[model samples]
Target chain A: MAIVTPGKRPGERVANSKVLGKRFTRAKKVGHASLMLTSLVDMFSIIVIFLLMNFSANGEILYMTKDIKLPSAQHGGQLERAPVISVSADSVTFDGKQIATTEDLQKGDVLNVPELEDVLREERRRYEQIHVNDPEHPFKGLVNVQADRKIPFKVIKRVMFSCNQSGFGNISFAALAKTAGEGKPLAAN
Target chain B: MAGAAAQPAGKGGKKALDAELNLVPFIDLLSCCIAFLLITAVWTQIAGLQVASSGGPPDQQQKLENTIDVKLMLTDKGYALTMAGANIDIPKISRDGAQNFDRKTLSEKLKTLKASLPEQGSITVQPEDAVAYEDLVNAVDTCMGEQLRNVTVAPMN
Candidate 1:
């Protein structure tokens, strides 16, 4: 037999039980309000791993200035960490310091550049000093050249000649890597 | 945690260790690491082509003299391939309206030269004043493609 209160009808008793059951279920759901941190952490882990792989594969990074635009080459190898000489259409800089203008560098038919030679000689001396203490770190006389694509080969030759004269015999030309099937010819300016 | 500590020991007398993990600081550290890695990532790859400017070791020079001296001169008209004693000229032929050296012919010629003189590893590339830098690099690329690694750029007067 259903026990009913004196003021309530039998139907009202059933309705009350149903309402209490719904409230119990709603109260049980309130405990499940947890943040899905595991999925977020999983996503971040993938991104971190991907970025780390790229960082490792990328060898020495060359910080290029705004004045130079390196030409694209299909056969360039990894760049070594060395002194950088940047040549643009208007000016030339060594280690980010402006040393001479394009006109001044190509002033005469003379192959030697005096100002660049002086700067490179100082660099060689500094390297030699560093190598005096550490025999393992001998001076390799390597230099990196970052020239604008529009610059003529004559100016490049002059710069290269100057580098040779300054005792930096090993020269490396900086270029952007070109992927296969790009089909776009390199800009000729 | 205080309420649990105040409770009478059930079963064994040992206190239960707190197992809740603090994720706020851990998430903060991960965020910082991700941001740093993203900021330091290198997008474009920079590469180099090595060339020796002048004098090398005596032994290396002796080895060089044993083989032919290949000189590739970039002229406005075409590429002049001079092999110390042999004279071979490849004129600039236009393909698709752009004046360019005949790369195929040059490559074939270089392959023949490489076959004849296997010890020759260097080639001197001299471009005229009017020649573009890209053209010079392209010529170098062709030379390198044919197994001539030691590419030296000569000064143009």
Candidate 2:
């Protein structure tokens, strides 16, 4: 009934115990190592890819306005340094000063000619002075406009026209940089 | 797998190995990142006139041509069209009629200015801070109507 030869029992029992111990230990180690490796590799690869893609786009400072929330457009790239100008929904600011209010800035708003002229004159004089000092150098200045994304094109045209008169030939609008974040906006500079 | 096959050879009954798979969490993370990149990529293309500068002796001579700049200042009251650096007088629209464009007078004035200019002349439109949107468009339309197509909305220098 025992199914074991009477003299072989002790030797067989010792051999089986040793073999089972070795096999169990090896299986435990392999399972732990492989599970850890899979996850560690997965996390690292994603991080590296996201960072590389983010920095490759254009180098531009984004101007955010309180009044305008620009809907994201599909076009993404880096823009060179031009003059930076920011227009809040109701006001325009350049070089850290309020240039015009919505009533002053909106194309539909009543035009205030003298004040607009004064601002343009001031901006132009500043640029001209900078260019005059370095005549040999091609001025790479651009007017970087940050306005409410929802404001109409007419307002943009008026702003552009004013800048053009002030002698800023280059203008660019600031957009949020493309990254692995949507509905969440990156901070604008 | 080899160990499991070898288990059946023992005197004891065959053992069982259990494994489960549900990859939902990993899939969720990847999808989030992909969605973010896709949505933010839309606003990337920039639109502006490319800067073109041709370097040569001829370009220098072209630059030397006496070009008069006409500045059209737009205000809420109306437009103050100026040229040769002198402020041009424009009659005010009554406050009640502030939004209306006196098209006939505007067109006539712009036409006269165009008639006096030579070919390839340029004008800088300077819209003031308080200019009405309709008025600015009217002014631009008027300038185009008068055949001054080489228009630049430049800031005052």
**TM-score list, all predictions:** 0.76, 0.38
| The candidate that achieves the highest lDDT relative to the unseen native structure | 1
Runs of candidate 1 with Cα error greater than 4 angstroms are A1-35, A56-61, A182-189, B1-29, B55-66
CAPRI-style docking class of model 2 based on DockQ? incorrect
Q: lDDT scores for all predictions?
A: 0.77, 0.51
Candidate 2 segments whose C-alpha is farther than 4 A from its true place = A1-38, A56-60, A71-78, A106-136, A149-154, A173-189, B1-157
Residue A105, model 1, lDDT: 63
User: Which residue pairs in candidate 1 collide?
Assistant: B78-B92
Alpha carbon deviation, residue B10, candidate 2 (Å): 35
Clash numbers, per candidate = 1, 39
TM-score, structure 2 vs. true: 0.38
Candidate 1 differs from the real structure by a C-alpha RMSD in angstroms, to one decimal, of: 9.0
Error of 2 at B61 (Å): 16
| Chain B TM-scores of the candidates | 0.71, 0.50
